[model samples]
Target: MTVGLVVVSHSAQLAAGVVELASQMAHDVALVAAGGMDDGSVGTSLDRIMAALDEADSGDGVVVLADLGSAVMTAEAAIEFLDRPAAACLADAPLVEGSVAAAVEAQGGADQAAVLHAAETAWSPAGSASPPGPSGPKAGGGAPAPLTSVFTLVNPLGLHARPAAALASELGALDVEIDVNGVDAQSVMMLMTLGAGQGAELHVSASGPEAQQALDVVRRAVESGFGES
Candidate 1:
């Protein structure tokens, strides 16, 4: 099962728009928008946040991303009111970046903790190293060899939001440690920070069970211009 996400913002449009953008790369993950008041004015509402939390949950836990201070407070209040507070968490991250990152991880079938970490770490610099490698070697100590490939982003717009999301979503599913030009391939924010133009080369490296598969997928997507004509 995949974790779900909630976007809490002061503006209805902002919250809904963020969900729409994130959903492009995470279609299967549940994303609920809780924004504005009952009358559609600009404000956070406890009832709305509570309802969104309930609707976003689907057996799997939920991670909440809020835009402003009051929105965060409202989310916390909603969680505190929950009989099972552990089922949800308020991620301290920028609304747009955090929502997109969280959505990508959730789409990859990550559990609640992983999803929360993904969102919380969206603010980290793109060039920074990943959280850390798995505790130890595999049972047989026969870890897969590192698979590497280099491809130039050919799309006219380069690796923009949509393309970044596409690449991140696909790579996120693989059991691999992938880096595109030194940035986490599974992080949309980090990928976007590349500012990779049309002719920029992407150095992809991974070492895990599906390392080669992940490399191939990225190669095909880049070569195909990510389906953009």
Candidate 2:
């Protein structure tokens, strides 16, 4: 089962717009927009957030990304009102970036924890070191090199949201630890952090049972220009 996402904002247009943008790369993922009050004014509403949480969940769980302080507070209230609070949680992340990242992760079949982690890390400083290795370094030496390859981004926009989401959604489901230029391949935010404009070479590597497949997926997406001309 795949996790879902809810975008909450004071402006109904903003929330819906975010959902629309995120859905471009994650068409199969469930995303709900809860914004504005019943009268369509700029304000948060517990009822709307609760309704979004319900519509967004597909049994696996749901991750809520809210804009501004009141939006977050409203989301929290909605989560608390749920009979099963653990089934949903609020992510403290920037609205657009977090929603897009979370949507991609959810589309990739990540669980609640992984989806939340994706949103939380959306704002991490660019070029930060890779996340901790799955296991500590081996006593004898460093871990074995993963299946690796290099591909230059040919699209003028480089690795923008759509391409990043496409790569992350396709790769995140694989049973592999893949990194593109030292950032997690399954993370849309990390991929965007590269700011890899045209001709920027992406160092793709993977380690796990599906390493080859994961690497191929990224290679193919990059070669295809991620559907861009």
Off by over 4 Å in 1: 127-129, 133-147, 208-210
Encode model 1's per-residue lDDT on 114-195: one tens digit a residue. 8898888887965353555533454257765567888998889899988888788788788788888988887888999999
Q: Candidate 2's residue-wise lDDT over 1-229, tens digit each? A: 5798999999999999999998887888899999899998999999999999999888999999999989989899999999999989999889988888888878877789988988887877532423655444532366566788999988788898778877777886787888888877777888887889889999987887899999889888888888888
User: Which has the greatest lDDT?
Assistant: 1
Model 1: how far residue 112 lies from native, Å: 1.4
TM-scores for every predicted model: 0.86, 0.85
Report model 1's TM-score to 2 decimal places: 0.86
After TM-score superposition, what is the CA distance of residue 167 in candidate 1 from its true location, in Å?
1.9
* Model 2 stretches astray by more than 4 angstroms: 125-131, 139-142, 208-210
CA RMSD, predictions in order: 3.2, 2.8
